[model samples]
Structures are given as C-alpha cells and as structure tokens.
Target: MFIEERTADDLALIRLLDAAFAELVARYGLEGRSGVGPGAHYLVAVVDDETVGCVAVQTTDVAGTGEVKRMYVAPAARGQGIARALLKEIESRATDLGYDRLRLVTGHLQPAAIALYESAGYRRTEPYGTYADRPGTFCYAKSLAG
Candidate 1:
C-alpha cells in the first residue's frame, strides 16, 4: 500500500469522502458538516491501486497546529492497520510542515477510533471548534517534539 497527495478536484476521492462521512453520520448521528471550503489537502491510501483510505490535513490559527479532517478507511481495510498508517503519514506531513500539535474531533460512539488515537499517544481534550456545539464530540490532541 502507498499514500499519495490528491488535488482538490479529485472526484473519486470526493466520493470516497462522501461515503465515509455518510457512514459517520449513520453510525453516530453526526451532523457531518464543515464550513471549511473544498481546498483542504487530502492524502489517499492505495492498496494494489485501489483507494482504501484517505485523510485530510488542514491549517488553523493555532500556531504549529494541524487539524485532522475526514479520515476514513474502507471497511475491508479497517483491521489491517490502514487507518493508523494513514494517520502516521499525516502526522509526518504535519511535522514537516512545522506543526508541533495535531488535533482531531471524533464522535464518542466510535470506540475503535478513540482507541486508535489513544494508542497513538493522543489524549482526550475539551471540545474544539464546531465540535464544541455538539454533544459527544471527543477531541484528541498530540503535541509534537519538533
């Protein structure tokens, strides 16, 4: 498997993101809406040429911080550590971009996701941004060394 950066107009990735986010809403009753426009940078995980997972890294006002947005791994690829790989890749990019902190907001109902972040050294934090307006939004943050 490999990861590649995707352009904003990549329709295939946009469809994948739509499906992934729809699942999030169906599973946790999430609103799944974002005011952040469509230019967010995306990374696609390909396994044998098939898009198995994807993640987006976006900028924020918080100095040295990178936001994890729209992370999703296809169901068949879930147990294979693809999500973790994608996250690690994103983190690496964040660090290279001079971000010292990485943060993400996920629904509490997604236990597996929470576990993934926790095992990756992320810690639970108070609600941030739009998540603060909704209940059960579990936010996690990890401060980088460099």
Candidate 2:
C-alpha cells in the first residue's frame, strides 16, 4: 500500500471520514462531528489505487502542538497496517510542519484504536479542548522531538 498527502476535501478521503464518523456514532451513540478545519493536513492510504485509510492533523491552541483527527481504515482493509501507516505519515507531516507534539482523542469504546495509539508510543494525557469535560473520551499525546 502507498500513502501520500492529500487535501481534507478529497472525495475519497471524505467518504472514508464519513464512514469513520458513522462508525463512531454507532459505537458511541453520539452525533457525528467533523474535525477537519482550516490548515489541516491529511494523508491517505491507497492500495491498488483505491483509498482505504486516512488521517489528518491540525494545529492546536497549544503552541508547538498538533491534534490528530479523522484517523480511519476501512473495515475490509483492517489487519493490513493501513491505519498505522497513515498515522505514521501524518505524524511525520505534523513534525515537518513544526509541531513538537501531537494529541488525539478517541472514545473508550474503541479498544482497537486505543491499542494502536498506545502501541505507537502515545501515552494517556489529561483531556484538553472540547474533550476536557467529556466522559468516555480517551486523550493521548506523543512528543515528536527526538
């Protein structure tokens, strides 16, 4: 599979994001929300020219930090490392964009996602931003500095 940077509005990436939102809503019984915004960076994973996974990063209020958003891999594409690759690519792009750290929030219902982030070296962090008071939200952060 090949992964490359893409725009937040890319059609295929939008479809993936929609699917991810739907899954989150079903899993968490909450309304879907969009995380893409101005200046966000996106990366898509493609296999046989078909986009199967995507991730994005956007600047956070915290200086030198970025927030990871819209990380998803199609259900059929799981187990192939697509999500992991997309995440790694986005982290690299965020670091290149001058972010010294990255943070993300995922619901506790998503054990697989939590495992992925933890296995990737992210550690639990105090909730921040809109998630600060939201229960069941699992916040994590990882420093990009070497």
Give per-residue CA lDDT, model 2, range 37-129, as digits (tens): 798888899999899998889988899999999999999999988888888888899989999999999888889999999999999999887
After TM-score superposition, the amount by which residue 138's alpha carbon in candidate 2 deviates from its true location, in angstroms, is 0.5
Q: Model 1, 15-124: lDDT tens per residue?
A: 77888878877876547555334556788999988888989888887888889988889888889989999999999888888889999887877889899999999998
Q: List the residue pairs that clash in candidate 2.
A: none
lDDT value for model 2: 0.89
Cα distance off (Å), candidate 2, residue 122: 0.4
Estimated TM-score for each candidate: 0.92, 0.95
Candidate closest to the true structure, highest TM-score: 2
RMSD in order of candidates: 1.6, 1.1
Q: With candidate 2 superimposed using the best TM-score fit, by how many Å does residue 98's alpha carbon deviate from the native?
A: 0.3
Worst 10 residues of 1 by lDDT: 30-39
